[model samples]
Target chain A: MSVYTPLNEEQIIEILSNYSIGKSGVVDGIKEGITNSNYFLKTSVSEYVLTIFEDDNVNLDFCLNYMEHLARKSIPCPQPIQTNSNDSYILYDKKKLAIFSKLKGQTVSNAKITNEMCSQVGKVLAQMHMYSEDFKKNFSGVRNRDWFLNTYNKVQGELNKENASLLDEEIKRYLNYDCKELPTGIIHSDLFRDNVMFQKNTLTGVLDFYYACNGYFIYDLAITVNDWCTNSTFKIDHDKQKSLIGAYEQVRRLKNIEKKEWNTMLRFASLRFWLSRLNDQLFPTDGDLTTVLDPDHFKNILKDRKNYSDKLE
Target chain B: MSVYTPLNEEQIIEILSNYSIGKSGVVDGIKEGITNSNYFLKTSVSEYVLTIFEDDNVNLDFCLNYMEHLARKSIPCPQPIQTNSNDSYILYDKKKLAIFSKLKGQTVSNAKITNEMCSQVGKVLAQMHMYSEDFKKNFSGVRNRDWFLNTYNKVQGELNKENASLLDEEIKRYLNYDCKELPTGIIHSDLFRDNVMFQKNTLTGVLDFYYACNGYFIYDLAITVNDWCTNSTFKIDHDKQKSLIGAYEQVRRLKNIEKKEWNTMLRFASLRFWLSRLNDQLFPTDGDLTTVLDPDHFKNILKDRKNYSDKLE
Candidate 1:
């Protein structure tokens, strides 16, 4: 038995029928998640994914449109299939459902993430950011400070005196700091290594667009570096960081201010995860199979950010 | 003006009047947390803290008893103030609350933590573990894994695919691993640097007993190492790690089995925070002031654990 809600074959076929590109044949539910429902649909022609939105309020239409936009721009993303009515998404039994052409590849684990794969992931993220120029008009997601503060506040009750004080100071700093305005567009807010698919060093597709939003392009790069470039111990691999940043900068030239804010961005990015995890530790959900992340993991990151605050200059 | 409900001076005083501690001059509320409410109280003799439980359902009585036990054993902790009924806790307006003699010191921030301070933290944690042998019988506080998994399952609906998979795998690994069960006692599940007070590198007191529970002694050490020994980038400092472990071993000898499970324990410790943060990122509470930790931070830790897992063997 699955910890989360299980999707039946009928539901999968019903959802896949909306997508015009793929025919529904053998629908095999993939054990990819403990939270949401995912099925791999193998039609006579090709393989595709059928996903049902676990949260009804999550904007699936915007996600489908974003995926379509990325696919059109030559970004390696799963393209959503149009329904019989030619709609990209379907509202079935009060749940938002969509089908997409599954990219041919595998989710790369840490052991499988080679230096070459790291560079490829970095380059692909850069390309996605470069092509995200008009993303705001199409889809506008949460910004940096708002997102951080909102998430932080959720776990505010769990925080002890020092952490609460540190959080207050950090929030004040971010609010007072004059964030330089830059180009705004769609960003893959949660583009960690597992979300990106690869086949022997070749980038095949990028998955998990749930966190996609309109924010500073540099924020996306920071998220990628924080996710893909850093080792398990939260230590940055200097070579990998250089390679990833080099690839990103080659595609989209960061402005002087963006470059200057990179370190703070990194710090902010690290703080982002720390605060989120702390909240979960305080108030957990039902049927979720994952462990609560340690709030201390980001304490080190916060400390590092304080030390290297001037290093980015 | 606060995001949470504010307790007035009279209400706070009324709640503390029942406690057997010396009458202290009460100050306004200093901080309000998810788990407890904090008030700074000063008496003619000394200063103390007035902590009110926010959640009545959680084991407030157990935590207070544990603190009292540690204090009797000459452990440095905030001694609990007894109520008028000679009970350690009181119910005011349906909220559970406790009072304690406050310890004075500053939290060890990244700017403040030193090599010596790290060692002291380790020593204190080891001592607390040794002293907590009778924790379960004396005080009935909650355990770590149950608290973690329970909350994770609650918000399972909001999690994305990759996060869910990671959570499932981690929970399974922890269950399957044959940990050398040492003295089952009260372990401070969260002994981060911020939780420990420091007066010039001498450990003043260990605070935040909300997460105190019955578990393996080494798990507490793992939590300490995970919190105190890492650098800014979340990487473990080799010297700091050695110093921390060395200090801990000096206080409580590490059996060979405990040493063997050290790496796995560390990885498990890292996962604890990672899952918690991921859940917070997905679901947040209302009117909270703290920042949500970034889920990516733990993703980095999880990756590092994959590399460090072999080092343990």
Candidate 2:
């Protein structure tokens, strides 16, 4: 939600010369994306989003290739605009950068997420999972089980006894309960309601694949359900949940192992976000303008997922 | 460059219900405007910019009427969007808010302001002044001369001997100086490069009229020239100044008094911004996402304008 790199017009024109996207007209810094500085770059041809990755940890190559792979399969995702030299990325002030065709449509906020909208999102998620299988490159998602353990250890002193014990129990649960037979694919692990854009009744675009990596397919579904199917008070709207999962199953039926471990996956997803948000609150990064999401939202979700496991039935 | 208010879908939809702008689709918080919260609202019918005034001093009625007056003359500015009840302003969270038809085109950054571009800006600015003469409402710009004396007095203790004397002398000179016959009208007193938008060679829009009020038009021109014509090292680019002022003369010839007081107006504009920026640095406001512009930029401009007063000829 901030422009880290303030580029001048000459720099923008020089950057555009490396691409076949024609001359740059208007380059407005978009106050979106926490990890990268994003700009809405317009040209005579069309509009493109020029992104400069601020975080050193992001692997630009893998993210670009993955989006390209999905785009090649007619998936509604932002396709990276290749350079004239046929390179996927550019070097700007030593920061890894890329231009992407701006995705049209607006993100449907959680309050606007109807059962039908959830169903659409679920179908799109399934399609992305199916298409991402052929992606040859691999990058492990950043927020893995190890991240949970490390983050919890860092913020353990700050958490109350209840939260600390709950985190410990959840960490042990995820580490101990492993099902290698479960389905796996490239998952948009951060598929929040804010990440998907809708055009009327149709889901026009899916965005922010910075968290994309090989992960349990059912876990990805849980992440989506936790966000899109949850109300402001963190209660699950069962209609949204059923519609989303039912529509997803219509495209690709869940494996027996996935179905058996669905409740556990929901708990795992809830705890993952709760730990990350807690870490952000306790031990924040040096990003000039980073949004600190409330950890209590996911804490409530974790509590609800645990005590009301029967409610999911 | 930040969103102060984060509205959810229901809030946005409810807000749009007050207007006839159709159903809201996308409500993106635009990270512009330091003194107000702004959002780019897209609907099925058209686009509008929603602004929530953060400062209590803003006269909403005067500002709206001034814009409506200019808009009636087909001036290239955002027209205020009225509510279903025909009220221009709405009360949202106790903040005075209004919707304006989103202006087209992109702001030309300082580095991209070519001589011809500056000329176009000058022409449009002159036209705005001409069109705004009949504006009935009166709101003295908050950054008027008296503000300089008050702010400088407030921050004098923090300034060094040399700096304090410079401010004292400037204030005394402004207070003693008399030019009662100079052209005065509704002026866009802060027409910095980022505030004006251009499409190709043509000026498409001018924005941020929150600073618009009854003031010496020459002083407004001086403020603009100080920004648009200054280079990296804060030296006035003589060619840009010549081109801009020359083109402005073609629309509305500068009065003899204006020309005689040109150097004084230049110093006045510099002093006004310097005091304001210094005040911001010294005594900051409680705005959630207020941008603190460097006071040194205007200070340097004042230094250069004083030392090289002969260069303007």
Alpha-carbon shift of residue A65 in model 1 (angstroms): 0.9
DockQ of each: 0.01, 0.01
TM-score of each: 0.47, 0.50
Candidate 1 lDDT (Cα, whole model)? 0.67
> DockQ for the candidate 1 complex?
0.01
Which stretches in model 2 have alpha-carbon errors above 4 Å?
A310-313, B1-313
Candidate 1 lands at a TM-score of 0.47
Maximum-TM-score candidate: 2
Docking class of 2: incorrect
lDDT of each residue in A1-313, candidate 2, tens digit only? 5646677889988887776555555688987677788889876444678888778777667887777665543356777765655577888789888888776688876446789999988887887776565566777878876777777789888988998898888888988877899898889898898889887687878899888988999999999999988877777888899999888876667887887787788899999899888988887777744689899999999988888663333
